[model samples]
Target: MSDRPKTPTLDRVHLPSDLKALSDAELHRVADELRAETISAVSETGGHLGAGLGVVELTVAIHSVFDTPRDRLIWDVSHQCYPHKILTGRRDRIRTLRQKDGLSGFTKRSESPYDPFGAAHSSTSISAALGFAMARELGGAPDPALGDAIAVIGDGAMSAGMAYEAMNNAGHLGKRLIVILNDNEMSIAPPVGAMSSYLSRLYAEGPFQELKAAAKGAVSLLPPPFQEGARRAKEMLKGMAVGGTLFEELGFSYIGPLDGHDLDQLLSVLRTVKARATGPILIHAVTKKGKGYGPAEQAADRGHGVSKFDMITGEQKKAPSNAPSYTKVFAQSLTEEAERDDRVVAVTAAMPDGTGLDLFAERFPRRCFDVGIAEQHGVTFAAGLAAGGMKPFAAIYSTFLQRGYDQVVHDVAIQRLPVRFAIDRAGLVGADGATHAGSYDIAYLSNLPGFTVMAAADEAELKHMVATAVAHDAGPIAFRFPRGEGVGVEMPERGEVLEIGKGRVVREGSGVAILSFGARLKEVMEAVEALGARGISPTVADARFAKPLDRELILRLAAEHEALITIEEGAVGGFGSHVAQLLAEEGVFDSGLKYRSMTLPDIFIDQASPGDMYAVAGLNAGDIEAKVLQALGVERLESRRA
Candidate 1:
């Protein structure tokens, strides 16, 4: 309790409406208290710490100035919305961030009216805000009576093509919209590409701080009497300052590279823009990632995503690991493969650290590519690399790879280019929730013609799959692995490339066969042991290749066992579906064989521990055991429900 920051000013303000009653001086204090409160809350229940911390004053100012809930405020990649949530009547539940049935870490429309649009993915806010603005003009939602549509986007998100797409459309429409480009100059990893460089130059030039405030509004937006003066001032400012011209060309009235930490500047600028803006406007506010927190500021990622940490010391309390994380293992394996083969090159979409490609980059600097949140381009780029006689490993998260599906199909699959896709976070990820869950890659990628899809059953299997992906140069190949630690199995000294379209049996048993895909083999083994207690020992086999189908192994399993159950940490139309199709085609089901496919439910599961999430998906050991009992027509006296 003593560790909790003193938030007396924050305690008085329950919502944005309550903030209206406070004076400007009190508002400044409120911003301070809000930052403190956000830090304290996140310290207890760790989440996106630095991004939220960066936007503290900006959040307070926006809510204070705007009539929120009516005025739609959309946060780009909303990981930074924790401070916004705290100010908008959710301070009481702030500590419950990212837990099961608790307040989501990102902005959720279902969670609060204050959250006008839900987003976890980056560069979406501008597009969503434009829609809202268009809707307001067309009288779409008359109930709340939409006032102004505002999108607060980060500079990192600006690197994506989608942000520019929205900007181009918004510029064409010429609607009265507000876009606050929160230029902290950092995304999860230090932002890359031309956008980062452009923003740096925008703020880095000569002293135009004096001319900036005077040229806030577009010349056409000002009164006729003041129009000429404003025009002259803008022209003078443009010559002296390197800022505003790029946005101006895009048909937006650009204002500032103002200090985002300054509440006074934020409030002043927002108030003026809200009162007098005539067309699309963009306010560039410069902020420091992990502002006001020494430890986070000192850290490389700016404390991007953290576990529960000490409030004062900023030391995270991580549980002791029994095994190396799947991410680290993948990195080590990829690095080793890169050593053997100089042709091996890596690519990531602004997720070098997350995908463990940072290690790859450190060893082979020139060979690695960080494409700066442009997944579509990254995929095509990897395809081009493959076409030019290089083994390109596009290491992307399963969920994010969806963005580049068309490129994967057209450029890689159709061209028969050998692009090795190291798909990370291959299952229901914890905390960051449904938006980030890597559920659909198995289904999406497996369905593609000439694409080879494999899921690693364990860390050792992951190593072998990496080796396999590097060796196979016929077509595009992908291997998926989950987010957490390995199953604590003994690892191989070196990965041996396995033959394609084959599977290995883990434990041989009778009556039923449990053909497992991905990391679920660990859970399947546990269920096998529990089934042993029930005198029902089921055969367990790891289906290494999902696309190739492992036809012989699957058919034999179906023929030998009374019932064949296929389990995978993926959605429907994946490994299980492929196996089912193979069985139906082979006439195995007609031979009195009962077949069941256990997969992730159709609905999107929310944030929780990965174990809890899989439990909800009904893919746990108990769920597997119950499923086997049901499949074999063997009733158990003990309730599996409990």
Candidate 2:
């Protein structure tokens, strides 16, 4: 074997087919190379470093053992697919990972054939893998051969109900499948669940390999019909002792609690499992996040995802910020509210720091709860808190809120529980891209009965919205804000509660009015300034609430202005859609009113700088001004000075 590191070899093989040609020893070398390449790529691009590093060996082993593109391998959440991407004809583009027009931060179906199923959110892989397995059985693939279907999921993702639902179904159906449990005992933060605790105990015990061997030996000793009966009995005994009391009970053949980083062990066990696995099989592989990198491993959050950093020093190169982020503002505001009112409490779904709930947690530890990545549980838990006369703020990211949509409708909205949803990252997230984008909350939340949805136009507005959520005790209320630092706008000394369903006109103008919603107000202001230089002064109003929509103010603006434009930082069905529905009901669009709705285009935008993504979505000031001028039928040259 060459003394040089295997990553250099990995740099040469850009496709899965290339990996297939390599010998077993060469494949082991490729695994090390893949790890180094992944570490280097993430170190440069600043994305899900820890999770991706944890699965490097697993990625190589799976690709080496299975005929990928023919046999689908679905990675749960896909945050750990950097190594997988490197091996699948994407190594050349690794440097451009998360850059504009470059590789996606998560697995994208559009990006490559190797990504059989795309995922950004957690708990999706098992269901998707099962679907692929069923589809293969239904004659979707070129050959009728039962294509291998595997799902590599983390112990953290297993906390969510969907994974269990998929496992239950897969077990019952007795489908030929592989579910590799990549247990690192962390998920952005240390995972929380009875299941997580159970896995941790199993990891400590190290009984899986011994029990499996003993069971197999006993099966081989019996004869004929008695042998089959003994085999079944052995399975039951193994389930009772080790393999899986839970999974085997659900009807799957539980195989391991193996060491994920052990190349020989992983390859040997995988080769064996691949041969005789009749029903669904679960392989529990324990790994260490940030496995190969010392500095990353030492970091507080295990360098889960990072910004561009110094490779030698492991120090992040951060852009200096004048003001705190919207998350911080929300946390501070919520903490203040909790201090003032004993009923106030905060909850997050595995994102205390991201949601700015860390401050609240620090101040009032008992009142704060981090419910792992189970957004559905977080919502219902908040509802339970509310039902018990406690005010619970279900602080979750806008993208994650999608996981609890049913809970929001059934447990909170229908029952009219006062669960304050502090929806963070409420618009197009930049480097993390579309999967993490808070694009659908406005549309999804606004339409729910008894749901009061609001958008913060700025940091001060976010503070007020938090206060409003605290004060409002009637029903489920939510306020969304985008990702990034506040726009250096003046913050309030203390949060002041604002009236529900109200809007404030920021700048007064004639002929054309721009209705700004959420974090897009900064861009709206810039557009207004640009239009002023062009001698066309446009009115700008911040319509705070998406549901109870400041309708009278909107109608007044419509009556006074020659043209009206509705702009929001969400997808088609959100704030703009609500405005359109209101206007149509009021007959604003009946007379062919000069109108336009600005929203994110119906496309999964790739990773890029926030400004660049905004420009692409036409939410930037220049883009907004140009669209407004065009909508009003004004020539570009005529507006050179609107």
Candidate 3:
């Protein structure tokens, strides 16, 4: 018997206009049903749960008060937009979330009219909103695209520098924009719901409120003083520490630390702002993540990401792993190295659990640093730690490390600081799509002057590389490993520091040579086996270092083989490109040596399983065999005879 909550009120709401007809009490009922629906849909599909639950009333309030699609509502990162999707005419297809050729997990403009801007990455909403806000004021309103822009960003996301940069700009612009600071973490501004509203009302009518800086566009709708003993009241509120001084300093009229779950308060403030707000205003609504769901509320990260689960029991049905994940290998190996060296330390940008640094933190809490979502600052902070003689392993996702690239070059590479980068998610991630794909790190990091880059073929190799990074203090080094469970290879009793800039020959062959970088080594071997039955035995070698170019091994392979094929799970300018450059310099290509480089094509692939995505890329075992046969100018039909 499915205990799915009956949504009589929600069934009437097909769009935002339908929401406006409902009373405040009825709207609360709608939010409750919506929350139940969100949990139920996610239980079937397995996606982001806690974030959506936290913002149910806020989503309801915004849609009811403001004209969406006209009044642009941008969800920062959009991890919490499941409920927003439910409200904004997407409830029917909500069960198809994160599926192949179905609705995306994050906010996409193509998904619906209500999703004004696409966002999977954090700290980008404010900038996008400002652009829309500016366009609206400048008479550049396009059909169904322009209106008052509202960016709903979380407290963790605000820790990034870009959010402040956008806030600084939004403050200067003074466009009729709204920023709802969804402080679920309660890291910034304590929860004092009534006190927050009282102070906000008084502050809006303070002595500073009357002075409208029209030149800078800092003007409030509230003209002057409001009531009897107002000055004394303002002084008392100030003493109570109930004002949003940080946002106010940025030139936006700030409001609320109100109860986001309270429909009455939410509706009241939103209606007032929609009618009378002159410039940028930030509504600080403090709500608990996983607000209604008991299991989600109890768990850390508030059930942020999930697998398909039973709605009744709140138990996830994740597929059991045969081996440890690459993330765990890196964390465990780094912890092992830390046991040997007292100077060793680890850093992560707010994803301690995701990166497996929570285990490290448990063992050595003093050494493990969770720097919040400030990747740029995390990179530089690691650099500073390195300069001061501590060996800092900055563990960040390869996609996110792009945020701190300039810092990587200027702070670590230029100065020659030995900051070890343990890059997780080094290839296409499944449902998160192109935005979270770790496809560019190899190309980006390898081009730097003194940087050394390595990609682990499997979990065991990842352990060795962790050891290698710990021993190598000469300059900056990075080692990347893919997501999900590693191939069940035999575990080494202890890690051994591998020699720098070397390649290991995995198998011996004669007709052709297949040089591989990264986790594609396993696929290369499978291709070799498929080729073996056709009498085309190919030499296989793992090029450990992409930058330094395993000179002796590559040259020997190039000299002996009739054809050479290089493969990597990265874009064009990555490991294979470096191999091509090395071969060209050595005049290997001059001899008309049949050479091919397999790289990810110049296209952004959408959400699919990693296996399905790789199939789309044509880097599978069969794809590799076909490439080899073509390179050798041997017909597949003819090769079978030999």
Candidate 4:
């Protein structure tokens, strides 16, 4: 299209090999073109923008210097892989990112040979790279043959323990592996903890870049005759500047604090390392998250994730909504709770903004804790707070909470600590795809002894649940809500504490009953409306507590209704499974009552709009109504179209 950037240099490049033919000067031109193309593409497709923008020059330098596909290149969290994708034969579909049947926002092994390993989570790249290196050593090669393994990981990702764990093992193995620490001084939120500070000190202590900072171990890269002089020169320079002693201690050679945007500098360092490095080596390349674009650099998150936008102005084309998002509602409600109770505290794992803990942090900075990317530490830390006589609300995304399950089970549930878990992104989150969905928390939490699990039907219910979690200091409690805007309901002045293990009947009827466990209650109501048109009014109830199972309501519904259907916004092992088990144990099934459970299918759903994903799961209103009819053995409905 005419709106697309003029990328004369990038247009000539269809694969990594194409960059090999270009001069270093021409390669710089390609970097500029690639940046422009990335901005243009993300402005249309509405995916990760700044991460890719930051790495434009790095992308060009790597592809030009190294043999990719054969040499496995891994991107930690892979949100920055957009530029890499555009250069590797996927530019034709670059504009279709994160859409249904489109190219994924993150790297996927199935997508292309360029992407050897896929990940959306952070800090796994070094481990994966070491695996590739070991595979190469063991003569276990796939087609095209594995050569070198290079991990381009962010400093934000370095906060996680896994990165260090991999480094430790890699050092012990003594394999030839390369690690590029892409330091942008930012993750999704500004990185927290000692790692960020440690990296800052490395460059801040002195003019290390001016010294052309390379580790003392770089002397080992020299030829035998030149090694003595190079060692002497390295020792002189090392005394003048700070070195990465921490990395060197971990059993790897550390080099850099290089200007990541300078293509010539990147190429020089990379070429040297590629030719001469033995064993695991670390290259610290400092970058800016939003390197080129003016608007992106100015934004708070550096325009980390964006919707389609006006290309020139960089004004996002977001659909306006009157209803407050579930995240905001939770934050506001929690803040209100904190006002009443001094002991109330909040915790998040490197996602204060995503979990809406940013609002809480603004109000109660001391009480709000961001534990960086360490979910296990965050969970256990929250448990310790509870044990210390403080009410800790660990607001984490459903997918991320999975990482802390062992802690949740041991530190909280087993000990009966009153650590409140506020699980955001509780369902199939659109655009981010299955990797980020909150589908297993219900099953996982509910099964644990003395754990209280709840799912809110709407924002109002979420507020009430927050209050309930505050009031009930019995055991480990969790309440899950979906990702986007809540259904527009009348606002409550304050949250109310509801009775534990109780459910509310939204509408009462006769032959069939629909039991909803979460946000899917809205869709159930819609299905109920449609069913009423056919002169079949089914009873609809919101089962507030999934763990306690609302036994009385469930049993009463089973006794009165001919057919009962349970619906939830989770995997098959969650709410519906609990209800089925209860019925089976209670002998309700022997009485010839028709029962059905609706849940997200066994397969991981791909990225699409929320509506489309729900449709695929067969959990939408039409599907619900159809399911009701199927359960009741009602073949047809009266048509209003005639």
Candidate 5:
């Protein structure tokens, strides 16, 4: 530990109001302090570090210029909001970030008034800000004196259609809104698309700034009668040359490729924009992803997000575990499969590294497609690839896939395309919290007409599931796995494609049957062992497929067992719900069966360790055992050995 106070400058300010009190030079000092605090805080807790570091100065400048609670600062994807959190009354609680009953990793509206619009998914800031902007006008509070709506979005997020949709609306409406395009030249991975190239060019040339000023200067010099005509001509010339050609066509006054790291320059540019009179203006601020921290700066992905590490050495603190991560297992399996089948290709929505497709990309660069933060596009694009007789695996986080739900349903599922969805982080993602938790995918996808949803209980099962997904050609198939390492199970040398909709009995018992789905089966197994020690034998079955429920196996369990408990790593409407519906249809409840559906409770679970979060949700071994005992209507056992 350095002698310097933890979050020194950040600790002093409690709200955006406090930030508004600082001078330009003081704000710069505050930004430096904020960067140090953010880096240190993330180093301790382990979270999205590089993005937050990159936006430290921007965070300070924005809060200083805007009245947050009133102005509504909507962060596109709150991955970069650690500094925002520190400045806005969360400095002390910063260390508790992503822990259960602690601060959320993303901007949450319910968490604070300062975070007007909460976002975990990318490309939503512009839409959210536009909503706030429209609401402000409709509420009869349109006066510039009141406040303005601003959206700080990343260039990577800009690749999504929603960002463009919001930009289109904002431009056409000519609303008094400011959109600060925080171009870090990266999302999780390096950005893709023509827009990315365009932004990069603009940042390098600085033509947008020169042209805007010259156009204004030229218009001002024209005689009174010719002024309007010159203004129109200048607009035309600008449309031809620079003046927000993309945004202007959509209806915005585009400004800058400003240096986001330069505090004075940022403050000056922001102040100028704040003073300007008309329409939606976009200030493009070019920033390096990992600005202050050397270790993060040197990292290939700019320490995008990290585990806890040594502050001085920047070496991650390793928690000794025998198992590999589900991500690693998936990557290994996919790479192995691709090696065998050259037709297999991988795609990610600006999250190649996060989804563990980076290894595959390295091995087969020509086959990997990084579609930027455009999940919808990525899904449809994969559908296109699949249509062309290629095995396109759309690797995306479970939470992010929600953005492409329509595309999945209409483009792939309806069309019966074989788009393999490698859904990573399918359950409660710890530090990132609700924004990143893949709680809804199971329920949502299960409801889809032709969707195949599978959950891996362990590393070996994940390999089998990967093989199964690759082999399936009937329709879309999705396999979900948790965030952390897999259980210490021996990995198979070669994956075996299991029969779809078929489940296997892991443990044989008579009194109770626990239909475990996904990785939560480990907890179910533990509960079973505990129950056995208490002279209460329970059967454990791994329901490999959530959508195509194993009716035969489930029916057999219902007929034989005293009670059936369905456990999944998702929310209410998913596997548990499907199981309940099946039992109800089969008249399994006619005998008045004792049943309990264990799913994530209907609330946004906060950031915590995965184990802690699961414990809170009563999905841990102890919790599972307790729930089973309660369902059995039995008193607490003194000892499992009894």
Candidate 6:
């Protein structure tokens, strides 16, 4: 903060309205200052630095050319909205990005009018923007007005089929929509899929570029001086049967493969499009992911997501962890399993690094698959692999797994394809917020018939679950683990396969029992210690599998204990709900047993530290203690603190 850079041109603008007052030259200066400001701000609050740096000029140009808030500007994924936040009215709070109760890392509709559509997930902006565009034609939101709808999507986002679906519908509806494809040749990882290859070829060679334009057949849309020559060129290409660009064939005007970093080009094209666009239009702009930032540009992944770092040396100030990250543990366990079983393979949906499957890919290149951003395809593909006698572990984030639920249910669960699911980020993720939180996987997966759902209490348990999944081929089985480092514990030489639907007594006590699931066992132990101070020793048990409930152990606990509490880092209708159903069915509730379930509250948590988010969810140690105390009918002074 002491070395906060001065933003001269950016300092003058409070909002997009102020941007309109500046000359084109001044706007260029603004873009420069904006980049400085973005780097400085993200240096202090590290989150999605490269993407924001990539979109500085585009953000400035769009704001300068279009009347935003009213025009409904939607950013696909919205991770690059940091520059937009600064250009809009939130510049003052730029440094507070992704902190507790601070500005969110992603766009939230309620946070500002500028973010008309909230998005942290990718490829959704086009669909949302098209909705706004169609709404304008059909008398959408405003009392007397409906303006233009523009979506600035990434080249990576284009890989998703959802983008095409929206474009197809937008083409059919024929609304005046503007779609900016920010082609940086990268997403979180390197871009893949047909769309990326097509975009890459669009700018690779001279003949390809010229032929691409001719293929688009946009002669009249060309400049006046080149129109006649372009028309002759287009006629030749038409005879060659390279009719038009994919976008043009889909009923939208295709423009560019333009220079996104050049303010002059971006501003000129935006203004021209604003003035003349009729139906849907695609503006392809090529730019570097970490533009104007030396450290970010040099780093692998283009410093996509970062930790708070030094401005001079881009050295991240990440705190040291006591143990390997849960992601790393999963990778290690899976690698060992793969070594044992040649039939084992890994599949990830665009998150090879994040899921730690990149390591697996290194060890077993032929066995690992990176499916790009297509989760649905990845899920079904894994199912097909399983059907072909391969033990395919689909390693995907819990939040992202929601996208492939239909495939998971239909192709895997219903068919009992035995596609093992390695669900990462199974609880409230800190800075990435609720959009990325793995809060509902337990509920969603457990409810599926013939599906086995397990939660890891610690790193050792995760290894066992990985082994258990490898051994099981009865049906679709899944195990969820939270983000961040595991609680430090002794490393096991190899994972032992555990019996399905079993519970293990971690600590035995008398009056009350706490059935903990997932990584909440650490907090449960802390809660037990706190309760111990009050002379209220409680029994703690780890309920490994939620789908096949441990009826004997749970019923025994219910019958013996005065009260039993279930705690999990998931929503309602998860392990707790299943236990409740089991208790009611077994007539355990008839004995007047006090039962309580501690789960995440019915609300989306905002970006914050993991501790702060857990506090908000009322699932922290103190909250767990209160639930335990309340269940046992103990009148405690500390309950007020919780």
RMSD, every candidate, angstroms? 2.2, 3.5, 5.0, 2.2, 3.5, 2.5
Off by over 4 Å in 2: 1-6, 20-24, 143-146, 206-244, 587-593, 636-642
Worst 10 residues of 3 by lDDT: 211-220
Worst 10-residue lDDT window, candidate 2: 213-222
Which residue pairs does candidate 1 place in steric collision? none
Model 5 lDDT tens row, 223-244: 5797788667656655555444
Off by over 4 Å in 6: 208-229, 232-244, 636-642
Ten-residue region with minimum lDDT total, candidate 6? 212-221
Give the C-alpha miss distance for residue 105 in model 6, angstroms. Answer: 0.8
Off by over 4 Å in 5: 5-14, 19-21, 140-146, 206-244, 636-642
**Of the candidates shown, which would achieve the greatest lDDT relative to the real structure?**
4
**Candidate-wise lDDT, in order:** 0.91, 0.85, 0.85, 0.91, 0.85, 0.90
Clash pairs (backbone) in predicted model 4 = none
Query: What tens-digit string does per-residue lDDT give for candidate 6 at 1-642?
Result: 557877788889998999989999999899999999999999899999999999999999999889978898999888899999998899999888999878999999888999999998899988999889889988877763769899999988889989999999989988899999999999999987787777776676465456544434234457789878876775465335433468877887777667788787777678778888888999988989999989999998998999999889999999989999999999999999999899999999999999999999999999999888999999999999999999999999999999998999999999999999999999999999989999999999999999999999999999999999999999999999999999998879999999999979999999999999889999999988998999999999999989898999999999889999999999998999999999998888889999999999999898898999999999999999988877776765556656
lDDT of 1 by residue, 1-642 (tens): 777888888888988999999999999888888888888888889899999889989999999999999999999999899999988888889999999989999999899999999999889999999999999999998997888999999999999999999999999999999999999999999999888998888777655655564444234445789878876776776776774567878999888878899888788788889888989999999999899898889989999999999888999999999999999999999999999999999999999999999999999999999999899999999999999999999999998999899999999999999999999999999999999999999999898999999999999999999999999998999999999899888999999898988999998999999999989998999999999988998999999999898888998899899999999999999999998888888888789999999999999999999989999999999999989998987764455543
Give the per-residue Cα lDDT of candidate 3 at 14. 95
State the lDDT of candidate 3 residue by residue for 136-228, as single tens digits. Answer: 877786676576889999877777789989999999988788999887762221222332344345335433332211111212233455423
Off by over 4 Å in 3: 1-5, 186-232, 239-244, 636-642
Q: Candidate 4, residues 295-389: lDDT per residue as tens digits?
A: 89998999899999988999999999979999999999999999999999999999999999999999999999999999999999999999999
Flag the better candidate by TM-score, 5 or 6: 6
Task: Rate residue 517 of model 4 by lDDT.
Answer: 95
